[model samples]
Target: MANDRRMTTDRFFGGVGERLENLQALFKFVDTTEPDKAELQDWLESNTAAKSESTIKAYVGFQRSVGLLELEKDQYQTTPRGATFADTGDPELIFEALLENVDGFETILQTLDNEQTTTTAIQASLREAYPEYQLPQAVVGRHLEWLQAIDAIEKQQSADRYELTSFGKRLLQEKLDQKPTIDDLEIGSTYDRVELHEAYGGARYRGIAPSADYPYVFLFTGDSGTEHGYKDEFRGDTFIYTGEGRTGDMEMTGGNKAIRDHKEDSCELHLFENNDEAWSVTYLGQFECVDWFEEQLPDTDGDHRKAIRFKLEPVANEVEFTDPDLGAVDTDELYERATGAARTDDEATQQTTVETTRTIYSRSEAVREYALRVADGVCQGCGDEAPFLGNDGEPYFEVHHLYRRSDGGPDHPDNVIALCPNCHRRVHHGKDGDAFNQELISRAENVESDSGK
Candidate 1:
């Protein structure tokens, strides 16, 4: 390890119970008055819980070291993070500052990722992380207190043990993950909180983040809507996104307005989908709002309300390419995803978001690969060998869904059959296509049952 390293250390002001509120209080006080050291001590005695001069002195120095406070000439002033926390009382803004300016604060939370740890263990980590500093037990305790105050961590049932709360784990994931480079923002790439916001500047929360600094509006949608009883879905190629606001009729304001006016504002609308990864979302490429409509939906309070659902169309049609490496593709993993992606009309989970398009694409691709692998160049429908070999030197055969693709059927293995082009077009365009397709559906079902689905 390199000996040259930056150290971020905070002193235990007052006691081990030093917390975010104390810093918030100091920030509030300094917004109005440019107080000198004695004046600050007197103000702290009157306005804060700290009355001792020693504790007050420690508070000033600690705040200064953490970039929360600045000593200009002789008076104190709050930095941007400090000022923002003072005005909004939003802990995460302050948490961002702690991430940059306090050691052990983030280290302790990371150490407790899946398990609990003690103050002694945290102190040891701080000692290792910042060898130049004297990180005592009190320093670790104070860091733990701040984390607790911000609801990022909690004390375990055991008196000495501590662990990250759910919020803590998520916060750590977002703050610690590496920001994606420009090339990494592909159509299906996942990002920590944001890849676009950092690249172009926008709100980091809510469904929409309109950048005042740039001509861009970012829209996020997903199955996460299921959590809040809101619905977002993909109706064919159009993504139906429910506007923001959990309760009451959603008005044309904030994120909703930004998305609505994206075209007139000349701001590009970039779409992303919520994924399973904590503090992360998958980029779904750019979309333009073609239309919007109001519908009756339950709010967070479960009350019926009128909400706007925007119909967004992709700016450019996505071309699906057959993977040249399909021979080496993991069929088992693709099978699981394909089978799990059945189209659901469930009101609760109509929130398929981009899954219907993305997952269906996966589902069909997997089934085609699967059926071809099973057929050994023979057509399931016609019971004939393939007419020719493909460009890849593999026998050419097509996978046909029993239910037509236009009907929005799932591409599960049990519902698809390997067919030669003659049989494929016959089922689609022949006068006896319906009966032939029905017979093939039964044949496909039996085939999948006999082998694999």
Candidate 2:
């Protein structure tokens, strides 16, 4: 409701000092319809609640100086700049305009931009740089507060200092580029293309491509010997897998996206682990995605990335294959070998970057049968007999690892136990699974460690 036809650029700003509240009050005052001097004074008193009319007059004079207001005859009206400031309420643009027209404001901003100095420190620095302009500490503080109010700088409460925001940085740099647009990938569109290995591609591609749950089929060859990777393993009906979300310094954005897309029973995932040969991988099978959790995995690069580990159960009717090389080694013999290599101290557990090749050998069935035979048709846990007979007319029981093989626990008789299906599931998915596992570890007489059998 203000007229600016007679305004000139030279008459734009006059009384704008470090006190930015004056400009804020002026903007609020001009947002109303045309008001006379008395009405304007009343509005200023009611809104800003300034004790003195001189302070209010100074704010009004600053607005008139900057062509934001034009007080003619007796009525006060908003000029073009005032109307624009009232309409947008954008602090950054207002501050930028002030820098262009307001004297000494830009000098203060340039002196303190991107510097993490407090108000007192800024005054000291400014006095050192410009002794002629002996600005008081209060003036510097008001300048800092005004910059903060106009979104020109960020205040770090914890540090008791100041830092330049992105917008503030741009303002100091003398240009503000238009906001850039990002063309995000469509929900169902393929984001990345992965080449399935020649050996496992056939079995891994059992489901349709680009399913709602599985946007893509991922192939993970555990951590590069020296780098970090998901610890993935295959057991009877489950593929104990970790989510692929991180690597050394590079985050696998594609892998993270896959994790986000995964849904229980809906996301069909494939499992693969490293074999002995360099760059060789084995396709375990299709798996139904399950729960996931955050884990801190050691990164070979000395820095760490937040990793996500996932649990998966083998999908029904999927082909199962074991490493032919590890065929049924005798359990007692395997036990001796495992205990011999069992870690003796914390040194073996500390994560380090080792530039060496690693191998993934399937769990030995011979070890399972030996544990069962040792149990002699009785559940090692609960001291109860087998729940039922299998199709082969043998007692049915599940073999469990007292110490998880994933955590570098050896696959030996000393580390394995024979349990009924109920007890087996309970130890893995039960609320007190960890305590129960410890109990089983303590009760087993035949289980051996590095010290003895």
Candidate 3:
């Protein structure tokens, strides 16, 4: 039986020797010796049958893609797989241990039944089981699947669950009687690049490519010409052609012209445009420009005489731009205020300036607090105590703002309601609060009318 096993092992090893040889070449370069790209290229040229520099480079890239090599700072090093398992001092011994413990995967299956175990838990388990080996999760998952394919184990619904199969138990019993050989383990298969590319063709080729039609909001500023003669004084009237449209020429003719004619404090003009079906300009506003133009010039073009230059300059007034559907807002720093925690004189002065000029609020926290107050710390309809509780035993509740942020609802307490997490989730995503409230009102009216009848 031993001789029979030996012959099988020899056949398997001999058949796989060429593929393993290629992998061994990669392992040498990735070893702790840490050869840079040039050294690696030299080694590949001297050792491997690979003829061209491009082929060597391609092989090195393949090794990287397959987790056998990693590049850092132009130097190549063995990945965890190569350093710990594939080319180690006792690679066969380490591989045997992994194969023997295929049933050990039952622990993972058990862990998944209780809760979602993080990748960290699996790594910790591997470290405990094989203190000397550092196996990556990808390698572990691959081995797990191999065990399943051979009917040695079965996986449960949870990623961590595995059950030993009858074939696996029998294999373990047989291995106990005789020393295990490499033939006892399964050899992983490989494919050529063309085969792999063909296999993945459907997934790789099928998809929608994004086009420039995706709508995005942009701000445009008029060009600022050079300091040449009359151009410096007439710079205020130089209408910034925000590629968004020609409409800015007419819309800004009123208030903007006044500032340019009066030569009021250097001013900034804002224009909005849509680039969907057609380029259209929306609204325009002007504010006092408080900074030097030379510092704000865009890097794209030094020639400011162009129709429109995309440049942003510091201004005194605040401007808030918002996307209605996205519920995203961009605001100038005019709303940022200090928290009165300054200790130094300069900090104190800055704090005073900020406090006088800006206002700030924690919108989410405010909404949550308001919701708790409105619900009176209980379920509004069922009067059931909320499930979530604070450390102090206060019923845990979330705040729901009636008008959504996307619809321009203010984050004030008046627009908020206190609700349990379940109720809150239901209100937004389920029956919806407005419809539910109308149904409740209709039921109440029927009850009152029936009582009178």
* Tens-place lDDT digits, model 2, residues 187-281: 12221222342211211221112221112344444445334455554453344455543445334344444544555323445545554555444
Global lDDT for candidate 3? Answer: 0.39
The window of 10 residues in a row where model 1 has the poorest summed lDDT is: 1-10
Candidate 2's TM-score reads 0.32
TM-score of each: 0.37, 0.32, 0.23
Q: Model 2: residues >4 Å from true position, as ranges?
A: 1-32, 128-130, 175-453
Q: Could you tell me how far off, in angstroms, the CA of residue 179 lies in candidate 2 after the best superposition?
A: 21
In Å, residue 447's CA in model 2 sits off its true spot by 99
Candidate No. with top TM-score: 1
Ranking by lDDT: 1, 2, 3
143-256 per-residue lDDT for model 3 (tens digits): 454445445556666665565566656554554455322222111221232222222111111111110111111132212212211111111112222221122212222222
Off by more than 4 A, model 3: 1-16, 89-433, 441-453
Which ranges in model 1 have alpha carbons more than 4 Å from their true place? 1-18, 124-134, 179-453
- Alpha carbon deviation, residue 118, candidate 2 (Å): 2.6
Order the candidates by TM-score, highest first. Answer: 1, 2, 3
Top candidate when judged by lDDT against the true structure:
1
**Residue 419, candidate 1: how far off, in angstroms?**
65
